[model samples]
Target: MEKDILEVERKHLSNVIKECDEKHLLEVEDKFKLTYTYDAVGMGENRIPYEDVKRLSQSKALLEYSEREQKEILNHLKAYEFVKNEAKSTKVFDEEKLKDIHEILVEGIFQGGCYRNVNINIFGAAHQPPDHIKVYDRMAKFFRNLEQFKGNPLEKATYAHASIAKIHPFVDANGRLAKLVLNYFLIKEDFLPISIPLESRETYIAKLEKFKIEKDLTPLTNFFKDLLIKRYEEVLKELDI
Candidate 1:
């Protein structure tokens, strides 16, 4: 019943998108892209104001943000641009592209685009990541499984995000990387990008923990579906369609 309701909402959103003015749709999409950047960055615990993010987006001038915050926001914006462009092109999911995205995200902050050399913990989470030594082989198998995934785009994307989080491939920025990859997959599949809001931080983390601990994806998948529906409704409201 839930899946059927989501399918109905998806079809309605699709029809609305198709009927909306292209220029207006593009404008709304651009706005949502910035929102996604802000929300995604916030999720990483960089609590910069949305206005600051907007200003930074328009000009590179350093706002009141500290140097560290500025760099983080800039890199996130760059990652957003990179993912958007690649999704529109012939690019498909590959390990290299994933590394490239990570590199863009953490360019000046830390060593980017390379796997961690030491095992890590999720702080307070129930799922501990695999040993660093196993990352390569684990990620290889992950890619193989991803390639063989037979579910719809939404399911595949949820799996990708959860799997990456479980693998915890990088030393830092794992959550941000997973979210960006989620958007990448969604955009590649001709869906709008989602911004997990800062207000939903606890719930978002809880859903991820559910996946990490119980190997159940239904909670996170449903969470993402709700986000998509909200985005579609926002676009429709903005366009008065």
Candidate 2:
């Protein structure tokens, strides 16, 4: 029974990652704006976005619902809609465009879409920092890398994921947000979005922790490659090839 449960969880995680990556690639490749989804998820309850919650509510597995071309197009539009509204609604990022982008994703309606001063550990389990100021500075630095940093989307995504985990930003929900930011870069690059499956969370955190302290991304890279292959398979199947 334990083996069965583990196997089922693994399968579900792979599918979720595949669907997410493919759909995000669609957004990037087509140049569709999905900043709203980002802002919503990141900014909302400062937790997971509403759409994700809705997705989960609708289906136990968010990625189980495959997106065809038409639905895929609409999905981009939906994400963009939330992004634009959130952008217009607040100044979370202190930059109009970035705010729009973050709002749609991190802070949407279903969760806690638009509030501030909330705090908690967001990565590798939740441990309160010794000094909040030190933690805040680290968080700020991570975002700075996103702005002043240079690299390809995959490079940026990988780096951002590592940095966020290193900083361990947010009082809570950093893991989810880290991936959202990673997806933001991936979608921006027209590449598939990548995520750590729930089943792989432990391994993901272990590897991410190593990257955080030692700045080694080789293990994470291997993990991402596996996710990419799964996404490619999903896309191929959708085309009925």
Candidate that would win on lDDT: 1
Error of 1 at 113 (Å): 0.7
| lDDT tens readout by residue for model 2, 116-208 | 344544433433333455765666665676767676556667887667556544443444445555665555544555435545656776777
Model 2: lDDT of residue 140? 60
What TM-score quantifies how close candidate 2 is to the native fold? 0.53
Q: Which ten residues in a row have the lowest lDDT in candidate 1?
A: 1-10
Q: Tens digit of lDDT per residue, candidate 1, span 63-181? A: 47787788888888889889989988996689999999999989988889999999888777888999999999999998999999998999899999999999999998888899988
Cα RMSD of all models vs. native, in order, equals: 2.0, 11.8
Please identify model 1 stretches exceeding 4 Å from their true place: 1-3
Reference-based TM-score of each model: 0.92, 0.53
**Residue 155, candidate 1: how far off, in angstroms?**
0.9
C-alpha local distance difference test of each model:
0.87, 0.49
lDDT of 2 at 169: 41
